[model samples]
Target: MKEHPEGGTAAALLADPRIRRRLPTAGTALGAGLAVWLLGGWRLGLTVAVLVVIGDVVRRSRKTSSVTAWQKSSAAERRTEKQLKSLQRNGYVVLHARAVPRDDDGVSDGRIDHLVIGPSGVYAIDSEKWDKRLPVRTMSHLKLFHGPFNKKDRLDEARWEAQQASSILAARCGFEVPVQPSVAIYGPSIPWKVMRVRDVDVYAGNRARAYLRRRPKILTEGDVERIFEAAQQALPPKYPD
Candidate 1:
């Protein structure tokens, strides 16, 4: 049975400080409607009130979606970071928003969402937030389907990011650093705990911590520290503040 009431999402939204501040007060639409009624007919006044309410709702939705969606994609990373906190005490070191040159052009394509180094070896995890309404399923081990959209490009990108990190870390650390590529999907129900699809690991976001822990510990503590330090220097912060 669910621990909380069924309207938990609605309750959480009502409680969020950011969303609460944006909630329309009682006077807005009513005041506007009254003003219109004084100037025009009741029909016009009703129309004006409806438009005002709709505008307010649309504005709030836009702001919230932008903050939580791809325009501000860091929300997924932050979620995964909290989930991985227990790993710290277990000798795991995590790097967030790390950037490295994608190629000889020296331009950074984008930042890796998370880089994890510790006993389970090095991992480059790409945290994703997809629409919950859409069903995520794989057709064959080679193809991933999100509704009707194929995620071949996304899988390829994840692999490339891991390979890039592996190359840089190996060159800097003077040893082979095989960084495993993985994706932790949020906002949708992933059918599997962990699966290797198109050479990259995929799993539900809730399994982020367990996903890494389930792997055998291949590196000693000393090796972990050296690579963690090297990764810090090699993969500079994408958004240095």
Candidate 2:
């Protein structure tokens, strides 16, 4: 079970090893070798194992590194969902970890985390699960961190997601609708100032529900319901049935 109901349950299912489907168990890669040594010979088995290992390595090399902003964001979304349940008594819906459609630029891509399609315009909550202090300047792409940090946020990744989602949604509905972008932070001592980054809302995962409550509704209950229904139909196949 997910920590919270809503979308988190689905997200947890996708992340589960028992439930999640891997591409394959190298069956195709070792099929030829296994066929050649169907007599269960030890030497054939060793050869098959080696071939499988090589195939696995080659597959790994072909794949883009798993370290991505979207993967990192999902971690934050999980934390935020738990926090949302604590703070909001009612009037908020959670979709958990449903992956969004891929954008033009191929990447891991994010699911519309914890969709808050309330009276406010549809909010595509993006999670940022981070630790340590960050010295972010106003209207700048670079974020300074402590302890000899060498990594930085990728360029236009968040914006690209928001824009892509908005365009796809608008096209689907035959109406121009704005999708709000938010960053949910799951970290110790999250600074208040960072929440106001370039007028884009950022909040600690724990504060998400409360933070949302303070904002005016951009969509009505009916509108929220419509978006929710549409989202369910549009979720990727990896999501729960």
Candidate 3:
């Protein structure tokens, strides 16, 4: 199993120039507020100080939310990657954070959380770190609801991503590569061991490995290599050398 480097989304967000710019602006506001509080009249100074503090608080809140989301996503990716590692001894090739093009124009839609190629077939896995506070409820027509948020479309998106991966591999290998879409729900209180919605597998974090392991073998050793090669060629490198 070839291990592709992780830290794609989190690293990109951290290295973003916009974040660097915001830090200095926030610092300037904090310093100016302190100066006003020390030299100006108490009433006016207090007002300015309070306003600045509120602004800073809001800014920090947004930043913290982004960081927290990234942390959760990174953690989920690591957990799933660890589980997938056990498959290497069984002739599975795993690729992490593989970018799949969603359009014919060559623009990437998003990166597949994990791509697994083995004797069973190809899989395009999407790892989700959903809030565990709210229980996921399935309504009519397999509609999913978490808290107040409707998550039914997530399965559709994952299926589209898998189809895109299959198309890419098929074009490269001259044969249809059936890519199965799976959503590994981490940090969620899922009711079922494995839930299938629109043919997409939705399973809890702990059961991801077992769910994948249960897949029937469909490809040979040579087929795995061929599809893996095609994947490497089609997807972008997770990290730059």
Candidate 4:
């Protein structure tokens, strides 16, 4: 097994050990403050230096290094998987990185991050790790906007994935199976407990277990077993190569 991770972008500015270490970070702030002092005033420069120091402290507290999008997503999945462990103990079945056919969805690459089925019926969950600097909010419960980016396409993709799962399970189980679509986001705080936007449930990634627990439990033990069997066969492991 590999000890180190993969796919991390090395920022040119952040490559220097001087910039990363506390003493050097303080030195850089002092330099900046000195430059500001010449242009503006001493008080203004002091304030700017203090702000820079505080900002660097906060950044180091949050993360030590820069990571690519894939790295962030992989981390988010791991965090969510940890949350799903309790669910597994409670008779729930969780499938990670299952392949769901595009079926002309036009939105996804045929991937369901986590498919959970238990007492709350079925769920197709997509894990997301967005920038914490941006605020996450829903517009009238019909749209989700993260900073300036609209998440309509993502919502649609999740819904389509769940719909495809529902179709496959229904065909094999010989009954209608409704799979709830959801997006479990990490990093940025999700302001709402559970919000339905464009037919997809959205919540914080850490709330994975709690979210299911709060849902209306309608599936019996037998139903969970049968559906789990069907899904295991129908949706192959995405990483099975």
Which candidate gets the maximum lDDT versus the true structure? Answer: 4
- When 2 and 3 are scored with TM-score, the better candidate is 3
lDDT of 2 by residue, 1-241 (tens): 4456767788877789844434254455466567756777758876886777687766544342222332333455545665655533445555655666665655436555555556656666666665646542233524433235532332234545566666766666666667666676566455563344443566556677667676676676666666666665664423443
Q: Ranking by TM-score, best first?
A: 4, 1, 3, 2
lDDT of 4 at 30: 100
Worst 10 residues of 4 by lDDT: 64-73
Please write out the lDDT profile of model 3 over residues 103-136, one tens digit for every residue: 5533334678789999888888888888888888
Clashing pairs in 3: none
* lDDT for residue 231 in candidate 3, whole number 0-100: 93
Candidate 3 minimal-lDDT segment of 10 residues: 64-73
Per-model CA lDDT versus the true structure: 0.82, 0.56, 0.77, 0.84
Clashes of 4: 0
Candidate 3: lDDT of 144? 71
Error of 1 at 172 (Å): 0.8
Native-to-model Cα distance after best TM-score fit, residue 20 in candidate 1, in Å: 18
**lDDT of candidate 4 over 1-241, digit per residue (tens):** 6533332334543666754567677898899899999999999999889999999887654442122222333777777776787887777989888888885646887989889999878999998989999999988989899999999998999998999899999998999999999999999988888899999999998887788886677989999999999999999887764
Candidate 3: stretches off by over 4 Å: 1-73, 103-109, 238-241
Which scores greater on lDDT, model 1 or model 2? Answer: 1
